[model samples]
Target chain A: MKITDPRTAATGHRVSLAVSLWLSLSVLLALVLISIAVGKYRIGPGELVTALINRLQGGDGEVPTVIETVIFQIRLPRITAAVLVGAALAAAGATYQSLFRNPLASPDILGVSAGAGLGAAAGIFLSLPVAGIQLLAFAFGSFTVLLVYVISRAVRGHDPVLVLVLAGVVMGTLAGSCISLLKYLADPYDQLPAITFWLLGSLNAVNPADMQVSLLLVGLGLVPLYLLRWRMNLMSLGDEEARALGVNAGRLRLVFIMSATLVTASAVSISGVIGWVGLMIPHIARLLVGPDFARLLPTSMLLGAAYLLGVDDLARTIGEVEIPLGILTAFLGAPFFLWLLAHSRRGWQ
Target chain B: MSIDIAGLAFGYPGHPVGSDVSLSVAPGEVLCLLGPNGSGKTTLFKTTLGLLPPLKGRIAVDGETTERWSRRRTAQHLAYVPQQHDAYFPFTVMEVVLMGRGAYVAAFATPGRHDREVAERTLRELHLLHLRDQVYSQISSGERQLTLIARALTQQPRVLIMDEPTANLDFGNQVLVLNQILRLKQAGITIMMSTHDPGQAFYCADNVAMLRDGRLLCWGPTDEVLTSANLRSVYGVDVAVVEITKTGEHPGKVCVPVMSDPRGRADSEIQAPPA
Candidate 1:
């Protein structure tokens, strides 16, 4: 009867987890199905289902070519890319916030995005192929994080987290300057547009191959993060307390940083530099399901996937030309952030 | 399990904090470390808990060298209650307590049913079962301290180390925590805690160790080691050890600091009470 009864508290967590999971998963599935029908020529739900069924059944070439092209080619890869990028960034953001004990921390706090941006810029300037550019971007992003880790480890004074953040900022600045130099040297008519588009972050050109690769990397990174979900709660208590509770804070931190960077790099390689999804989605998920990582992880993943998919749909249909995902995310995210600030007392734990 | 330290030296790199500290706490014994601020009490506690590697000499838990033991093994034998518990996330009291089962659980596995039962029983034993669902950050300082203690109890350790458990607590909470310590001692849990109050040493300690400027002033039974001379030498003050006898209670020893030195009057200007 009483709240403090162990049975009540235990079930309270389980119930909230189950309820939020089902609700978010339902919303996510509905959004995915609805988004498939929301392009320039909107397809009805029934038509969309029929097209999917025909495709699955080894089409006898009876399906309309326009319908087949639009559903399978135009929308499927873009929608899948949106969901993967959103989920990856959101999961990475949650891990960073917990690992650093700072709510302000994001996926890019370790300079993965900046390094990836530089790698993309240099790849474009060097005139690398598409696959080569993505590969280079991932490598540079991971390399930058490794350098930051090593520098922070070598430093003797200051808190470890502070040092890591400082190193990231310094490395980020260096990488940013290099990117600017590449832009200055690039041909304004040809390479400049490509660089700008990539930096602004868009899903306009995502293909099946890119989606498959990014999804594989994102899924690989999520395994460790999911397995370490319970320990992630301990990370928020700061290193000393975490260590006192029998955790090797240093090792766990390294594991989390590597996992988060892996997913963030993979996402950026596919979708350029979509921001705010990482920062805003976790906070929103925290509001819905409290801050326990066991519940927060899945909730954030689903909410992020749905939120970005909706935003992408709006980007393509809002006006004549497609708006960049980075721009729309900021426009939507800033207002939501203000609302969060106004209602932070709801539950900021 | 008991803690054994012999000729231990603890400090940061190029900064030696304390040395030659030799002491031991038997099973079921409570050892109160008394010292002024910055006297290396925290450093000693960290060394004993195996957080800081001893600069010299050997430290052991139950006669096993700490260096040979894994962090998890050391945690299994000992638990630490820090001076402050601050977490940014809003974990429930039950969740915070459940973290004590971390060492027992495998790296990739979550805590199981038995682990949760142990956590719940520990919370109930510490009278925190009623507050299990409350947010840890929303709880009072006293409740947070008790929650941390319950967490340590969940570890099922042989020795518990507390760093200033009563620091910042009000009168009632202070007494409440002291009684908890006594109860734990009765249940055969060895405790080693540091405190700023010498009187607290008299109340809960079976033995006492006093440190001043990285050196031990005295170490022995509480009554023999916490006398006026040793107290004055360790704290640089005049203190009288007095026994207060109640009508139907055991006599209790208290350290009364004598602050009547005339030199202290020059800056003793008093403010008049409001009308």
Candidate 2:
């Protein structure tokens, strides 16, 4: 009965969820709007808002053609793609970290990213079209996780999570070798640059069609995660505890792996392998709002969206030529990650 | 409801660790299981909790077969506290305790206000209400064990099964946990726990079961099953059950192992024949 009387530091366990959610959402909105305004064509905030309102009302005739094209055709697809990719990777990463009960577990827990990279590099070496390359990446990514799942299943009665991680490591090394082989075989003049660029990851080639496809797939993947968020928390406590708590740990783990894999594969297919969002955003969200998955999932998604959008904005606006997303993210993420490790004692609670 | 396990066999795949195990605990009774390392005490506990299927026999809970019961229903009847747990995420103590309400909560639903109330009450009952706000991982092992007990209590189960609940604890903390087990027995919870110390059986167990190499060696009232001979037979160590009497305190049994040599002896003395 006297529970609420505690004003101690331990009792201040979490930031108020509603307030954090609202603030993150507001910041995400502001980032999207501001990012649209800051691009090369220089659409002002006022013009952008008016054009958005006009477009929402289906009065496209009032807005100038260039402004309309810049907003809808150029920036909108890129911004939407960035947000979706960021949110998907972060959500999948958080789920992976929880599922494996390893803080080091990333979205590539099943070698999906390595498989995608290998597939994309091979596609580039063979001079495939952009769409063909993306298709190959998606196919290989999903296939790799499926193979990992199959291998883990083959070795029954052992800890499935441990088996999956081991399979992932072995398969990831295999995929990395394939990538190196492809790189070595690629033409030094044209194909090598393309292969390198794709591996480094780019949003420049992401169009409206790619955005639509990824949006649908990421949304589909996210629904089950949102529904099973609390179970994800339970699963993170390890298999025995989760089962003791009345959950079917194996079935739930399979469901989560498939869902997370779908999103990661779709995002990689579109954005080429943008790293760090999946590995770091959940930790940031955990620092903001404890480890309860119900709150952690949404918070990770919002923060990831904003963080990626801001990073992408800098990628496009900082120079004459566009920088790839992967490099910028690693540049920013690695140092921040180190800082997190340094301050971990204060923040983990 | 009391736990009623009969002819239970438990093991991992292709490895039969325990067989022909039979035990029963009545409501308000404390059952202590004594065994050596790898002697199938934990395997039997797991089988009783229905975490593992019995390889040979039937496990019934209050006259109902557990296989016919849903996980949620079984959890409502029986709760388990493992010897140790390492939680990956740093969930607060209260959140960890609230996990015990998972049985009552519907799938896809989070713990509600009523569940929180139960957790709070259980934590308070164990004198852990002040520590509820602390991070679970940051706590001492004794507090962690107590928190786990509080979590089990939140399940409101008729039977509680703990595997070596006092393992790795200081003497004071071991007594603390043992006292809590006694208190739980008084509160009408059917309690079963495993321990290496026979003295604990004498202290708290109403019934005792000794296991050795997948077989139930002895089972009966604590005083009957936990004699010096049974201890030596199960543990391969000679021990004496000595009585302790103190002023204004209840008399208790203390198990003292008979060690021939306190320090390591030279090979010559060790081989110095029957003398």
Top lDDT: which candidate number? 1
DockQ of 2: 0.49
Task: Kindly list the per-residue Cα lDDT of model 1 for residues B77-182, writing each as its tens digit.
Answer: 7899999656688788999899998779888888899999999999888888988887787788999999989988888888999999999899898998999999
List the candidates' TM-scores in order. Answer: 0.94, 0.92
* Candidate 1, residue A165: lDDT: 91
Question: In model 2 chain A, where is the ten-residue run with the lowest total lDDT?
Answer: A4-13
DockQ of predictions, in order shown: 0.46, 0.49
* lDDT on C-alpha atoms for all candidate structures: 0.87, 0.87
Q: Name model 2 segments beyond 4 Å from true.
A: A1-7, A11-13, A53-57, A60-63, A122-128, A346-349, B262-275
A262 Cα displacement, candidate 1 (Å): 1.0
Among residues 3 or more apart in sequence or in different chains, the pairs in candidate 2 whose N, CA or C atoms overlap within 3 Å are none
Candidate 1 Cα errors over 4 Å, as ranges? A1-15, A345-347, B260-275
Q: Candidate 1, clashing residue pairs? A: A349-B90
User: How far out, in Å, is residue A37 in model 2?
Assistant: 2.0
Chain A TM per prediction: 0.94, 0.94
The best candidate in terms of DockQ: 2
Model 2 docking grade: acceptable
Residue-level lDDT of model 2, residues A1-349, one tens digit each, is 6566433465375687898889999999999999889978898778988999999898859889899889888888989988888999999998898788887788998999999998898888878898889889998999999999999999988888899999999998899899988888889999888888988888888899877787888889998999888778778878877777777888989899999999999999999889999999999888778888999999999999999999999999998999999999999989988888787774333
